[model samples]
Target: MTNAHDHRADLTASFEPMRHFMILQSESDVRVLIRRLLLSCLLIALIAQLVQSQDSEINEIQVGDYVRFELRGNTYQGPVIQATTNGRLLIVDVSVDDRKSRRQVKREACVRLTPAEMNSVFKPVPPASKSEPIELTMPTLAEPGEGEEIALTNEQLPSVDVSSPTVLDWSGFQAGKRRINKVPFDADPDLPYVLDISTGTVVYSVASDHSTDIFVSTDRPSDYRLVRIKNHTVRIADTLPQHGVALGLIRDETDHDKGLCVITGLSTGQPRVASAWSLPKQKVRPLYCHYRRLLPDGSVVCVYENTLRVFDGRDGRLCWHCPVPAFFEPAVSQGGRWLAIAANGRLFVVEASTGRCAGSIPNLGKETMQPCFSPDGKMLAVYGENRMVITRINDGRVVLDHQANVDLAPFGGESLWTAPAVLVTPGGYLMDLRKNMLVWKYQLPADVNEWMGAPESGWIPIINDDWLSFVRIPHQDVTQLSAAVDQNALVAIQAGDSLRIEVEIKDDVRGDVDAFKANLTKALESSGYRQDISAEALLKAEVVRAAERTDHYINFGTGKTESITYRPFGARVTVVHRGEELWSANQAGNLNYHIAGGLQRAAKQLEQPPANLFQTMQLPRRFLSKKFQNGLGKSSVSIDGVK
Candidate 1:
């Protein structure tokens, strides 16, 4: 029995060791499983943190946040007034020409403005020194004896208004007047003369039986040129007064010394001799003389009889030439990239570099038409007596075809295209093409004789019997009014508020009114607003017109007949609460080309309500006449009442 017990003990001891080893192995496996679970939890937490950070960054834009954005290649900075529920659009309150205006921009295009940038943008700029009238001696012109060289000198003229305060400002437009004293009071009417505002230079002619004298004067007295051709008649080219160069013809009864001469360096404070070139006698017809133009790059474009010719400025060498029919005065693009001319009752756009036909627009009336290219060179605008057509150059697309109710022709001058608006001269009408409406019209003062504008400088020169003055089109003062409305709207409405929508259409209009109403309801719901017919806030939408018209014309670029059906739509919307209108918006059919397209765009606009809904709604009123002041200061509303 003792021996059996000892063997059993030894066996038990060995089994105990093995059991301990198995227990340790099981513990180690459990530890490994726990470690893997801990690692997985840590990885999941890190990934979640990264996703939250990205989401916050993407949704950082909010109302009242100052931002900078790009539109149409122009940079604009403003405060975010509204954001669309879908995060696609943002309404910004931007100051244009000192006027507070609401502009809608894509959210992706906006960047948060740095603190420094915001401060700088809001900083007040010192006002410019007021202009004081100063008199200077005008250049004296004396006819020289036959074959005698005559030199004329004049006192320094008043500095050009280029140094004057700009008509535009971040806060708004500042209207002031500056007098140009260089124009002689006793200037001969018969002699041709021109004032080039870009260079502050003037060229005039003095003719006598013995000699014809052409005098070129700049702001500096030392920079003056006098050209004398004995027994010859000098006629200053009326159309070639630009780029600090003066072009004219020196003609005699017998065709001796009959040629075109250009004077350069008139604006560089250095006057030099004339660069003379002879043209074929037959080519120097009246049409050629009237159609000549000096391009911005010193090249000269002229219609010589039946051909369009570009002459180099350095030596009057022919750079390029193309055959053309009878044409109106050609307009060179701001950068001299394209040349626009109306010929054979159509508009032709030619490449300034190679003289290749870039594009053309047909069916322009046979009546006189003036063509003007936009600053970007991507669009062309042709103005007629009753119609204005704007076309896109890349594709033969007619963007706008506006028929006016009155005579649309300029009173006595031509139309001028600036960055913000097109100034139709003589009539003093400032048309904002983006809105397709006339923003301002100046009533002529009794003393003012004519109106001419400097497109590059934004100066409108008014010629009176006494002197010339430069002034900007006066803009209405709506900054304070807009601010008041914006502030009121920002405080009046809250998220998740219940509202009602009502739509009304005119008898003449054709549209899906029900669809529009449904879209409005959806947009409001997406913005955290509940739609209730009995809600205090009532949104009213009225469609005044919706019609389509087919237009057929010849495409000058493809030389093919094309037809375009334009759908015109107009709508007016207002937000009313407690029997008072809190906000209003209107879309004129003339501004938008398509009915259905316009309605969809408008719905999208509504999806992103502006922070200052009142000011935004008043945007369409800018097109009204200045005397029309119906809703200027009616934004006082109670948020409690809206609820």
Candidate 2:
């Protein structure tokens, strides 16, 4: 494989669309980079040898003098007279691309002397032993093959469902934001979806279509595997913006108490660890690596086995670290200010900045499900065996309580003995700290229990056995929705009733599908079209419009756009001028909707035909007439035998 030295010796271009160069590398792009580096190193060594042979040894061997030498059966020659201080042979060449000849690129050759050459012309260089192994440090974001850097005892950890020993088929399941898969062996407990920011690849493994091992199942073997669809159609993993940054956990071989450090992904192409400036030097300190959370604040909260470390939002830096409870699962507030830890069926609300317990909820029976923080960061919901409890995060007071649904079945009947997968859907329950009473519950998906059980923050429970139709609750795209794509557009479509408009929008955001929908809707509105709107005051409104078939009649009347009826592949928008059918074009019956570029194209074609510049309008008999025989003003209005 080519090394970094070879590539650095001759890297005149950027690494965009790097896949095309993969053939040059032995394995992946990294190997190609290595090969390049090695080649450059060899050239430098060769140049140095030549320079020494010329120094104080001969005239005419001056700077700018070119020499050719045969060493170990390989010929080495390039124009280079000046010897670099570091013992490199320098040459210059220009790039050439033509029908006849090609040349010219500034080239440097570093020469190392062979034993024969040294004996005959200069001092002999010593040879090193071949048996000694050379250690190579390849930079990466996540720890490869190593166990978790942060260690915690079982007692200080949250009950995590890492799946089980049985290899289950989870292919085709849409991994919500983050999917956690446990290892069957104790070696590596967790394997989550990893995003490679540099390449824009959502690196993950599916149970190999034929494998029974979880590790084997979730492997990424393809270079351009589909990550997620943009606006429900176009695959977007390979796009520049949607690519994930790589991360790796590396232990500080020098210090042990500091624990482990996390490295972020890079696009350098040459394998290298993240630069220290990429993250904060302080937060980057070592700690028992437990679990890492992508917080709403854009910073990651990495819970150590014993300590809690907070880093900067952009770079991984030490924001703060505090000694805290062990064996606890950490939950962050939506506002990112407070963290809740569950231990011994009790809840401890800790200030995220200081890791000090601000409040505690005690006397919980049986093991407690992790506590949930409300969007406003005031209330927290804790699920117990028989009753689900809600408490104020600021104070240790019970705000609301309800008997847990005892009839709830276990997830896939995997382990009925574990705690019930209970979760409080957003907008589901109302809890007020001042008044301790359950107020209201929103209508959740009726079959939510059938899906992936209960919910956690930023992740929704999804269960769909059917391949064709799937339902997602807490409709994802609303967060980035705007007025341009919101309900205002719905009113415009009704008001204008214009004909023939089409557009293609592009989105390259790295996030959930909902975010894409919101952006697309906005783009549509920005292009002067109204979006369907039915709700008010939502971050993004879920716009649902019936997709009309090729031949269809749309009735937007009675102050509403009522319905659309499909015709037999012949319906077209006709313009009436001077009591004649000026022009009409048939809609393509193909299921795939082809959005034409603009109204100007259609308008230009329609305006040049049939030549009736003014006067009356001809309406379709079916639109204005009661029947075929009973028609309107124009004689051509009759449908039967009209052709």
Candidate 3:
């Protein structure tokens, strides 16, 4: 063999011996080394695993757990009850806050109070259970990071149910004439006071003896005062301003314009122009570059002619500003972001702060006037000669274009004080944006000189174009009631513990679902309700079993797809078939069905009642009962031939 071939074979042979040695190690040196390496690795792995396990321990209190936290160096314990958006927690302890005696301390920090940290005054204590009582011991306050566990146990509390009593209408109260002054006031649900701007004083219609002023505002620095005017003398009553005076026009409970009521003075050289103030704080400041629009965060949009501005109401500050075309009269939405204005004959919607053209409604030749925003600020109603346009603010889509003789000239720099024409033209329209319906028309009334000359204490136009008018739109409540309509024809109505649920099955299966859904929807609604849906009334109606039905029966738990078969009756139809068949066969069902039938006959409760009878009553349950009885009379089908 050649030397190269010999060397190759020898190298291969050497590698074979090394491979064999690696595969099978002898006990003395190699085996000992392998065992030592594996043992070291396993030990390291075990330590790592144990470390992870210890680190995974949860120390924070979970939801629904009773826990406590240290507040003002005192440890208070209660069920980690409920949390509010403001970070206040509701505990089980109930006590009244002693504003007079309690040493008050204000903290600027926003810290979530644990159930234990919250005051006990507002907590609802549950009634004590008669069952076995468990003892829960809580540890005293400990320093942060100190490893200590606090234990809390559920305990019996007082059983008290609080509710709002039926309110007596103010119309029923005796009327007495008293002169009052107008002053700056905030809109309060409790102490609602209306101000007449001309007098610069407040009118407190509600007597202090009749009702206590419960509302308090933190925005104003000084305590609010309740001033009374009697016999030409003004005196401050026992009431004091809970907060300082934040001057601005507030939305009134009634007898006020719905549009933004900003009282601005000649501050920025604009004649009869005043700066808009924030709602709660009422701090006066120039609009972000003097612009007017509402921001998305519920702040007002400020514009000064060409300059755009956005201000934060919580604290008066310019959030953002820019410049854009100044041709149109400015309007901002509630959010203060989207702004709509009419330039020349067309409409333009733009970003309030950036001054960028978001959208536009074009192709009009006449100069537009009197642009009114829908409640949501999503649409604008533009008035013109011979035609009125409703334009979408965001996309520039013309939602509605109604042609009519709407005078648009009166609002174009026509002085409300000088021209009677200003009263009839170019003012504004009241619109319900949610329903996309026009509710009222407003403009400065015509015959200004004649009407102003008329002898009167105040030139109160019983109806004026310049003044806003609110008219009810037909069936507006249907929009809200449609939301609560039962998918299955059944709804539960309850009174105390008594419940009546009526389910209806439509004879016309194809049209039944839709027709019944619609009829039930209308039945649930009533006229004069501001909003469409009343969740409380709907829930109450469900409990009383007085729910009107357009279909066969009120459904319980049965779904459309679910099938329940009666034992004796083998046929499978809707779930109602099973209930009917089962009742026909069972003795208990037969007895109950007959009893109900006899009651219906004895009382003649099913007799049809006049529609006008339902005007005074809210639910019209009696009317519904009569209608249901008429329906039942037409059909002979019953659970056990009880009819």
lDDT, each prediction: 0.44, 0.30, 0.27
Candidate 2 Cα errors over 4 Å, as ranges: 1-201, 205-261, 265-272, 275-290, 294-327, 343-346, 356-368, 394-397, 405-643
lDDT of 1: 0.44
Model 3: runs farther than 4 Å from truth?
Answer: 1-299, 303-308, 312-327, 342-348, 353-359, 363-379, 392-397, 412-643
What TM-score against the true fold does each predicted structure earn?
Answer: 0.41, 0.29, 0.27
Candidate 3 local lDDT, 271-332, one digit each (tens): 11012232221224322221232232334443344543454332334555443344334544
Pairwise TM-score winner, candidates 1 and 3: 1
Off by over 4 Å in 1: 1-243, 249-258, 268-270, 279-288, 304-307, 318-327, 343-346, 361-367, 410-413, 425-427, 442-454, 460-643
Q: RMSD, model 2, all Cα superposed? A: 28.7
lDDT (10s digit) by residue, model 1, range 1-643? 1123222232122112111000001124778769755754574365345435434212233434433222221233222233322212333333232132122222123444443443343321111122221111111122211221111121122111111122212122222222223223344312223344433445555556634555554444344444444554555553233334565555556434345555543332223323445444243443334345555445666555655567654345566765554434455666455666555445666665556554465634322544666655566677655456777655547766544333455533345565634544334455556545444445544222222223443444343333333344333333333333333332333456677889877855655667777767766665566779989877788776445555455546667765555555567676665675554545543322222433345433432223222222211111122222122322211111110
Question: Where is model 1 poorest over a 10-residue stretch in terms of lDDT?
Answer: 17-26
The alpha-carbon deviation from the true structure for residue 192 of candidate 2, after best TM-score superposition, in angstroms, is 5.6
lDDT of 3: 0.27
By summed lDDT, the worst window of 10 consecutive residues in model 2 runs over 230-239
Superposed on all Cα atoms, the candidates' RMSDs to the truth, in angstroms, are 32.3, 28.7, 34.4
